[model samples]
Target chain A: MIHQTSLMAIAIFLFFASTVIGISFYLGRKAKSASGYFAAGGGIHWAVNGVAFAGDYLSAASFLGICGMIAFFGYDGFLYSIGYLAGWIVALFIIAEPLKRMGRFTFADALDSKFNSRGIKLAAAISTLVVSCFYLIPQMVGAGALVQPLLGFPHYVGVIIVGLIVTLIVTTAGMVSTTWVQFIKGGLLVILCTIITIMLLVRGISTAPTDANGKASYIAKRGVTTVELQSMGTVVEPDGAWIGKKDPVTGDMKPAPYVRIKNAAGVVSVWRKDVVKFKDGNPDVTTFSETQATYTVNGKKNVNGLPRGKGEGEADLKPVGYLSKLPNGEKETGSQTPWGFLSTMQKSEAILWANEKIKDAAGVETTVYYQKPTLGSDFMTPGSSPTFKKVREEKFFGKLDFLSLMLALFCGTASLPHILIRYYTVKDQASARKSTVVGIGVIGLFYVLTLFLGLGAMTSGALDVSDSNMSAPLLARSMSEFLFAVISAVAFTTVLGTVSGLIMAASGAVAHDLASNVFKFKLDDFQKVKVAKMAAVCVGILAIGLGILFSKMNVNFLVGWAFNIAASANLPALVMLLFWKRTTKQGITAAITVGMISSLAWILLSAQAYKDVYGWDPATAIVPFSQPAIVTIPLGFLVLVLVSLFTPKPKDLAAVEKAS
Target chain B: MAGLDFKGSGEREKEDAGVVAHNTKLGVWLFLVYVLVYGGFIALAAFRPDVMKQPLILGINVAVVYGFTLIVSALAIALVYMKTCRK
Candidate 1:
């Protein structure tokens, strides 16, 4: 299945990639100067630019993460969609025209427009590069991830393919091709996803997901002690790194680093074997003597404790957290009201709502849990995007989570440099304003639909609780193969469109500012094109490498980090440049630099990084969490204020007149 | 709205406010209208969380019932523009 889909996905994507490359080439002939390439000579239609905003903004994280989240976590995923769309309110009212009126080609162009400080140029350029790259990594990872099931190729292949295709698209024409590509993709994705959702509602849940034997195309598996995990014809590590062979067939040479897990239970065991093409290649099934087992297996209990073996959301299968046959010591009447079950959880002192399991160094486990959310609705609780993360999940959360989520969405939208530069492509400030509204309309509708889609997936019995990213495509598969193919392809294109825009932004920053402004490398218009293309190639390669390395992280979680960085680093500087009359070169420069550096520093030292990357006993990070907007937004404003006060106004006052 | 940028800065300066800036003023109002629509929902959540539990006119809560009121405001703004545009 993986190989066939992977090949088909690759073939279609290549065809799409080539067609875009052709468009870029055709557009390039008309592009003469830096402005032509960077801003499409400021001549794109407003409607097209608006749709392009959807394309650029809806990254792999949006499609994969939201859908998967909805499938697994329910209403939590839909909340993300609301938060994301709410942000454009800021974009439409606050920053739209001011942005178009202020800048020439790039996001940095707007920030550096008021004061031609090399420092502002340097800082804004670095921030753009950093944010773009952070955003790019998730798309790259999604690229690799999507290729595995669709094209049947490895994740690395998918990453390389996207990197190459995006590089070709950007180098060919720059903003013109990128904009049109986004417009086409954005329009198609929203329409098609809506169509898919309608179909799902028409065909409601069934006991047999696809076939009657209760067999799923995908299922989760626990530890594999008896069976060997091999890669490249050799015994492999968890990461698929090749180790020396193990003769599990022979009793002698067992696989190195392989653990032994024994379970003694009368119940039948179901193991999801990749059967290849998935993690740990399928669990190698072996019958062992019951004596070595650590778990005594206190009978059978499902995630929600009902029947032993069946897909979730099946009619015969009980709803999760509602017991047909309760666990030992658990009591419930079948006739209980919904509110009774939920309200009891709210009052219970036993922590269930916000539970954390912590293990000390001596190998003792201590659990600290909250008991508020009883998973009554299951549709409206934590565990994914489009939903409020900390606030909706737990009670008594400080307003910090509420503010952080809103602030991330609000500032993240405008601060995204890819979304910003779209304004420069339109003819004027009015077009910028019009396009933003159009984008709001399109993006808003799609976000509302995500709730239905997420609900449909949850009920469809395709929600992989461990991995939410697979929710949408897997949900599509539950309905039909054709829908799965279409959804997967659109999801693939989602990554492609976003990564292309990001790479273009990064390339522009490197070529336009770092080369021309920082090093003072004087390149003619034609030479500038060449330099930008080279820069695209370099950034593309970097994104490809990072994407594969960080493939394990959820796309939306990574995207949240991107939002925090973009909001903290870029937003305050841009807002100050437009609104504040006293905004000096030093202020803009220092704000961008300090905001970027401090946020980046906080993320690296975060608890998430310690757990996921460092694999060490988690350290207490300086910031309350990795998200920096709560701290960094105010800091950027302060830096701008203090620096502007001390520094002299630039000799060039023309920027103030023209910018307005 | 589409080709306004082609007009020279001098042409723009010479032109009267003549419903263009009137529309611009309308735009400012419409933008504020949008803010109210979204902000109103949050306010309802904060101040009248219980109102969401009760039906307003229909079986829907006051929050759910008024959710479309915000979008309707956006439509009202859109319609106002359409009414005044050059035929």
Candidate 2:
């Protein structure tokens, strides 16, 4: 959807961005030491660190992607909310305290503290880089997505801007600035989302929602002028309708049975196609159908034709998603409670959007997005979307895919390098524990609000069917222009907070784990900090390039892959090291290597990747299911146990026993 | 070994060791309880979707109710752990 640039949005965005950059510059002095640069000098108050955890963890994917999914597919998106929040349980209960007690700088520090093995350092560092990079792609992509509608900039410009700002944030003050940025953004995101949810509940559900122009949101059918057909030959083009296809067997062009109307401004808009009838002795009659225009021509690059986006000489894609019928035939329900909202939605008929691809004889493809009036109960179930529809299938592999994703989400949080690094920023194990509780509370509240925000967008009559990620912001726009500006600005910071944290982890791995530990460099505190800042610059550049390159890809699934890899690779090593005394350095190294490679390989070879990323036939994918944690996580544990059984005890074990 | 001892040398280390062991034991038990609850949710969504679609409380179906419960339970358990565990 082409959004007119709003000065309000630009002003609000600049205000937030400048404030964040100001915080980074102010904190630059505190990060002169290695500990300060890497771990905020272990002095972040538990409360601030706790909100920052929410800020760091709630990336663009959480705010934009999940809400968009729920806006389009209802409860399936909420399934992600449930899975994601559950992972914090593992983080708080198992990983938080011990990790803080064990690690000094990075996740690798925690793993290598047991054996101080170079092999362990190398493997863990590589895993950290890989997971961080996988996680970075989606964030960069989301940055671009936001920039387009919010700032009226192209995708790459947004990617570069975020990349540069985050690099500056990380290079200047590292974790200190990163934590403060996250705290501010996280607090704002939760508070603003709560306000939006309250607004939506107060307004309640409406069957016929009007747009900014006071135009009725519903699209009605129109009758077209009759035209004569002559042996499937070329016919004179109609004044308003365009040819959608040529008869496949014949060379004759067929005008798609839709009518176009031009307003006083000469803006041409196409209405939905309904019926095309041919009488033996008379001209053919065509009638256009409901509110949405089904067929959209893929015009020349950046110059879309009528009824797609508001390009030159093109009509705007009508804002979609509203209730076609309310419960008991009521047109609107005003001022509902939270539970009352869900209960009302469970019975109403919502007009959702679905699209299909078709090709003309000229081989130009057109996407036909049409309205689908779905029962609230049906969409409110787990299998409303294609991604999770497998859960409704009888095939074991289908169900297993859903189960594996949940497992990855459950175990993935504690293993994420960025999340693990946050544990070290707090003062002690007690602080770490308290902050996690605080983190869970803040994050949990946001996830709950996402349900309302998404559902509210679904009925807001301002949905962009093509971009689900825009739903939350568009929902905000439906409420008020000021709210839209605030929500978009907050979301932009969401990307910044997450990207800074990931870069911090990546740079720490490169400097502390790879350069200092693995390569046996005798670096002082200043040198370590310098090397890490340089690494931050390099990683920031790489992230910007990847973000731009993968701009066209759907980024929601990449996050799932990150979780799978993080869980499969890091969890077993961290868990065994803390729990099992016999876990040798060789075991930790082997587990990290095997778990990372296997999950990565499985993801690359999985059906979802084949279809979505590689654009290949999914049937030929090697893996039975896309998510690898169900298999690779167990493989990690098994590899560690087997490798440890064969390796000799570390020399430090005897010394430690004697000392004890 | 009942607990892996990776702490540095000191009286503070010994004191933390006991607390860490106590917390780990309690954590593992709470973690298992959550796993059972979460596992039930995934299982029901996958196998018995019909049951998930049935109205459970008020007019909301089992899926929304169960999903909300899962999210609430995580925070609840975390708060429980924070209150009850040795800090």
Highest TM-score against the true fold, candidate: 2
- The alpha-carbon RMSD over the true interface for every model, in angstroms, is 7.6, 6.7
Worst window of 10 by summed lDDT in candidate 2 chain A: A224-233
Q: Which has the greatest DockQ?
A: 2
Q: Per-prediction TM-score, please? A: 0.74, 0.89
Per-residue lDDT of candidate 1, residues A200-304 (tens digit): 555533322332234542211223334432211232122211122346467464332222222232222222222123467775454221110111125532321
- In model 1, what lDDT does residue A227 have? 47
DockQ values per model: 0.13, 0.35
Per-residue accuracy of model 1 over B1-87 as CA lDDT, tens digit each: 123111112111122335444544555566577666766665444344455444454332344335434434444555464455321
Which pairs of residues collide in model 2?
A: A219-A291
True contacts kept of each: 0.03, 0.64
Chain A in model 1: its TM-score? 0.75
lDDT of 2 by residue, A513-618 (tens): 9999999899999999999999999999999999999998777898999999999999999889888888999999999999999999999999888998889989
